[model samples]
Target: MSLLDHLSEHHLLVKYTTKNEMEEETRDEGNIRKEDQCNTVKGLKKNWQKWANNHSEYQKHNPFSNNRTVTVQFQKGEEGYGRPREGSRTQQRGHSAHAHLEKEVDELCMIIKSIGEAGGDGQTRVAFGPLFERYVPISNKLVGVLLRARKHGRISFEGEMLWQRRDDDVIITLLE
Candidate 1:
């Protein structure tokens, strides 16, 4: 057989001794350090409550600003116009793929810039006040997942074959 099987086959004495000896071995290194540092299953609930309290305070102190102007722009990288015009199926797959690439690029650029400013360590978390602290981690993780996905699989529209071909090319134009 194999090394493990051979050992078990012959070494009956060791197996019997080993099983009983290790059975009572204390594996629960509970909180190894202290309440603040050691995060475990039991600690998760405890820490979450603490974090919840801090977050509540943060929200109370810093109200969200409604005065900031949101300007939507259109181009490859910026938020507004890069997206394909709505309801147009022309090169939909290609457009979507490019859009995904552009989005990933933008996200990576932002993360890298942040990381650089944060000294390339996981130490300083940026705070655009409390609003950013709440969303940055989740947003970073989402972008990371998307970027990783783009590396392997191709994005394409699969289902729904709509619009039969006309005798000549049928061109439709949309106005914004």
Candidate 2:
């Protein structure tokens, strides 16, 4: 967590607690002077503004224009091609998993469109069996991508969640 996030929530607990609890908590956490926090925040803002004001020419210093392959996962302390050193928080899980998300989604869409059965409402629907069998080889992150696509209203499935082999017959419909 950043200093900003820590400062916001840490100070709120003492305000809500009883006198005894507050005193105990304060003793445990140690006393933090508000002035020090304010000065630190101000210093950060001033430094950031100074850096932001100096806009170098794009032709001279364009980081993204570099041509090199960058792998997804690397052990801590190793840097990749053209990657920023900005203290990235997300490490193992979440956003790091979806490298070729667009291609995966396109392949999934094409697979469902090809093998899906027609529903009574005239929508193309495929069983989880076909999707799993076909897509797992293409991209092992099929389930995660499916959840992402569903979150964005691209597809709809009938159940709380889909399971391998168990929910093979569960129908999943591609939303047009």
Give the top-scoring candidate (TM-score).
Answer: 2
Worst 10 contiguous positions by lDDT, candidate 2: 54-63
User: Which portions of model 2 miss their true places by more than 4 Å?
Assistant: 1-99
Model 2, range 1-176, lDDT digits (tens) per residue? 99967886787764656778766876865677778768987999998887665433222334364524442444566775445434443333334555557567767878888988878887889989988998888778888788877887888998777899999998899986
Predicted structure 2: lDDT: 0.74
Clashing pairs in 2: none
Which residues of candidate 1, in runs, are more than 4 Å off? 1-90, 117-176
Worst 10 residues of 1 by lDDT: 167-176
Q: Global lDDT for candidate 1?
A: 0.43
TM-score versus the correct structure, for each prediction: 0.20, 0.44
